[model samples]
Target: MRDVIEGFLTFQQEIYPNRLELFKKLAEAQSPKALFISCSDSRVVLEMLTQQGPGDLFVIRNAGNIVPPYGPEPGGVTATVEYAVAALHVTDIVVMGHSNCGAMKAIAAGQPLDNMPAVSHWLRYSDSAKAVNEAREYGSADEKLNALVHDNVYAQIANLKTHPTVALALDQGQLDLHGWVYDIEAGVIDALDGPSRTFVPLAENTKVSALSTKLG
Candidate 1:
């Protein structure tokens, strides 16, 4: 707690002053470039990862970075997605998973979650991802974990499409969706390539194959 306070004090006194004009302009309104959805893990400092400053990336951090399919009753994620797309007009949405993600690790391992009922309920949103990984075979524990992480990212991207606002923006070619898995130790991001349906280095996954990039 003391560290958090001192961190804030440092930002308030020194860091904030350096970007005061940018902060002042941001105080009026925001026009973020992207919607970044990722795990609520302390190691995942997205601002540093993307090198994006204030008002650049509208973010949603949750366990497993899950986005449940849009339902008749809207939830926090659904509402946030709607606002980012319809109101803020973000052009890109990224669903990022990470290596050694506790949530995905639990879901893939099917670890008992009885004591943590709320966590179990929340993780159900990624059940489809678990099912997908289960359908395939892997040689080792690391392979299984890696597959699940990428699968969960893809699953969330599918869920994003189910949202009406996201769907509309996509149909009009105004928005793009990306799936990525950050390797903690390697300090690299593997992005999903739509053409190949494979995870490749971020730089290699250059083109975004949107709705039109499908086979008949």
Candidate 2:
């Protein structure tokens, strides 16, 4: 708690002043173009990874980076998505999954969650990912984890599409969806292509350039 407080104090004293002009501009309004969804992992710092500053990415984070299919039961993830699409009108939604995700590990290992009911319930959102892993013919644990991470990203993208606002925006060609897997060890991001239905290096996709421009 003290560390966090000092971190904020340091930000206010030093970082805020360095970006005062940008902060002042954002004080008026924001027009961020991308909704970045990722795990609540300490290593997955979206802003630092993308080199984005204040008012850049509208980010939604949770365990496993999961997005449950839209339902009548209200939840924070759903509400955030609704606001990002219906209100903010973000042009793209990027669902990022990273290597060595603790949530995914727990899900894959079927670790007894008797003491962590909420975590067990939240991870149900990745049932599709589990099914994908079970059906794969991978020989090693690393390969299985990699496949699970990528498949989970794809599954969450499909789940994101289930949102009415996202559906409308996509149908109107006003929004784009992306699935990304970040290799934490290698410091690389592989983006999934909707049309090709395959993961490719982020640099190989010219759409990332357009997204940068839109976000800027």
Candidate 3:
């Protein structure tokens, strides 16, 4: 807590003044270009990773970076998706999962979440990702965990489409969807390639953005 306060103090003294103009503009309104949904991992800093400034992204974070299928359940994820699409008019939605995600590892190992019932229940949204891992034959736990991380991103992107706002925007070609996996150790990002249907170095892929537009 002391460290957090020190960080805030530093931000207030050094960072805030440097970006004062940006902050003032943001205070009025935000018109972000992308909606970034990623896991609630301290290591995964979306703003730093994307090199995006104050109003560049509208973000949503949660355990396992999961987005439940649209239905009766009331959740912040559902509301954020709807607002980003219908109200904010964000053009792109990026669902990103990181390597060695704790949530994915726990489920892959069948670790008991008996003490954390809420966490266990929330992770049910990622059951599809677990099923995908089960169908594959992996040689190691790490491999299986990585597969779940990637699969979960895809699963959430599908879930995003289930929302009426997302569905309508997609139908009208006003929105694009992306699936990404960030390698923590390597500090690299792998994006889903539409043509090859495989994860590839994001820098090597020029077709991803264009492909997303077409998929809309």
> For each candidate, what is the lDDT?
0.88, 0.86, 0.87
Clashes of each: 0, 0, 0
Q: Which regions in candidate 1 have their CA more than 4 angstroms from the true location?
A: 72-75, 208-216
**Winner on TM-score (1 vs 3):** 1
Best model number under TM-score: 1
lDDT of 3 by residue, 81-175 (tens): 98999899999888999999999999999999999999999999998878887998999988888888888887788788899998898889898
lDDT of 3: 0.87
- Give the Cα error of residue 197 in candidate 3, in Å: 2.8
Q: Positional deviation of 101 in candidate 2, in angstroms?
A: 0.6
lDDT of 1 by residue, 114-140 (tens): 999988989998988899999999999
lDDT of 3 at 155: 79
Scored against the true structure, residue 9 in model 2 reaches a CA lDDT of 100
Best by lDDT: 1
Model 2, runs deviating above 4 Å = 208-216
- Residue range 1-216, candidate 2, lDDT tens digits: 999999999999999999899989999999897999999999999999999878989999999999999996456899999999999999888999999999988876778999999889998889998998888787787778888888899889879889999888877878878889999999999988665678889977857421212222
